[model samples]
Every structure is written in structure tokens, then in C-alpha cells.
Target: MVSDFRKKKLLHVFTSFFDRNGSGSIDKKDFELAIENISKLRGWSSGDAKYVETQSALLKIWEALQSRADSDKDGEISVDEWISMWDEFAKNPSAPLEWQNLYSKFIFNLEDASGDGVIDGEEFSSVYESFGLSKSDALVAFKKMSKGKGQVSWSEFQELWKEYFTTEDVAAPGNFIFGKTSF
Candidate 1:
């Protein structure tokens, strides 16, 4: 059984995805809206090759999350469904490695404003801030993740992703991937 703390952390992670509307539930409409917002924010366009790749990646993640968690098949995730999904997720943290890899790649691409295939410290800070993490903590995380390089490449980000999901160390830089969580 998942402990309360782990469950809360899992809930925070899951809710972060589909609770875009902040209605306290993940419904089809909310998911769709999130996709729309993300697509727009990421500059996804039909004519762009990156769009197809990113869209495919996104669809894979969406399908995985929905198929695993939408127990009622009504295209909505209730709190109970979230819990049930968390049970499954907690059982195998590495199960979603591909999903996480794709997600991290997409995020890296999104944050690499210079199109140089790397995220500078400032860009990384903005990403953290965008996720509601405090600036100081973002700086701390940036320092930890960048290792004094002041930039993170896609491969480095993948390593960080692995560490984020697998590491139990609260002091690990990966633990702060989502921000400094009191939980």
C-alpha cells in the first residue's frame, strides 16, 4: 500500500497534469483545454515536422494516463481514480520512463528559447517559476542540475528525469525537478 506521503506526492504530480481548470477533478474538457493551451504555448502547428513528433509524443502520454487512470471510462478522472492510478504508478516507478522522456524532451524544446537545443540558467529558472516554484529555489535547483555549467542539454535532462522518478533522496537535485515541495 502506498503511504500517505507518497500518495500525496503522487496526487500532486497527477493533479498537476489534468487539473488545469482547477475544478478539483480531471475531466475530458479540462484535459482537452490543457492540450489546447499546451499546443499553443509550444507553438505546435500542422505544417511543422516538430509538431507531428511532439503531438505523437503528447498523444502517447495522454493515452497512457487516461487508460491507466480513467477507471469509469467516462473520460474523466475522479479522486478515487487518481488514487487507484497512483497505486499502480507507485508499484512501478520506471513504467513511465518513455513517457517521462518524451515529456522532458518536449519541455526542453519548449524552454530552449534560443533554439540552440540547450536550456540556459535563466530559461531553466523561468521554467521553474512557471511551475510555481520560488525563484530562490529555482536558482538552487538550477545550480544542482546544471552542475556549474549554467545549461542543461536534452540528455542531461533525461538523466535528471530518471533520477527524479527513482531517487528517494529528498536532498537530491532531481527531487526538486518539480520544485521545492513541502510534501
Candidate 2:
């Protein structure tokens, strides 16, 4: 989360994470769970997460939120507290990780709305507005991710990201998105 674009990217990922959750919030325990998963994902495999989100995940996300969250000097968090934290993060997705955690706390125990073990084309499509991805772009992303049907796993996410996410924030691609994103 360095440049404006990276912040945008982080927000994109964050929004999706929040949307997938039934309550739209997360606590320390929830944050730890996400890190646990990321930690387990030691290596990449056919699109699997580079890291499953264990210590790495917790530390990263918490660092990301440190700036605005952690309101109480206590250090632990609750679901409501987390929601408020993410809201601020959403407003400034690229702010300093001075108070945030890059990989750990932000993405643990993600509540997949689709119940598919991962976010899917339909899920992403539904959430595109929050991510700032156009329906068309989201559709394109969905198509590439689905490759057919079902939810898009983290491994598949890598491939899809490479496709939809530009190599650089250099130039906007022509017709960035095409077709329709459907369930």
C-alpha cells in the first residue's frame, strides 16, 4: 500500500473481504484466523494464495489500520470496532500502514457470501461497485476467473488479477472490460 493506486488496490481487496462477511466486521480472533490460513499457504500452487494470511496477514492488516483504528488503548478489537476501522480504511485505502497490518489482521476468517471457499465471479460481480470495477470490467474478471463456473479460489485470483489488474497504473487499457458478469 504505497502509491495511490496500491491503496486503491488494497481497498478493492478490502471491500470484497468486508462484503463477504455477514456482519461486515472482524475482531482480533477473526484477524488471527485469517493469518493462520495465509501462513498455511507457504507456496504458490496453480493460483493459490502466496501466503495464507497467518502472522503475515495479521501483521499486515493491523499495520494498515493502526493509523485510525485501535481507538481504545487496549490493543484488542471487536467486530463493531473492526467495521469502523475498515470504513476509515476504505476512505483512505492507501494511507500509511503506520497503524495497519499488511497481510495478517485484515483478511482472516473471511465470510464467503457464496459459501464456495473463495470469492466467485458472481460474488465479485455483485461487489464490483464497492471495488470500483465497472460491471463490464468485473464481468471480464469474472469470466477469466470462473473459466467456466463456481467461485474463484485464491490461486485463480492471482491469474485473474494479472489479467484485469494492469501491469502498471501506467495507462488505462482500451475497453478495460467487456461482456457481462453473471451467476
Q: How accurate is candidate 1 locally (lDDT)?
A: 0.65
List candidate 1 segments past 4 Å from native. 35-60, 83-98
Query: Which 10 residues in a row give candidate 1 its minimum summed lDDT?
Result: 174-183
Residues 43-64 of candidate 2 have per-residue lDDT tens digits of 3332444343235545565555
Best by TM-score: 1
lDDT of 2 at 107: 23
**15-86 in candidate 1: lDDT tens per residue?**
665577887777656656655665565577666776666556667766766776777898777878777765
Clashes of 1: 0
Candidate 1 has which clashing residue pairs, if any?
A: none
User: All candidates' TM-scores?
Assistant: 0.70, 0.33
How does residue 103 of candidate 2 score in lDDT?
A: 35
The clash count of every prediction, one per candidate, is 0, 34
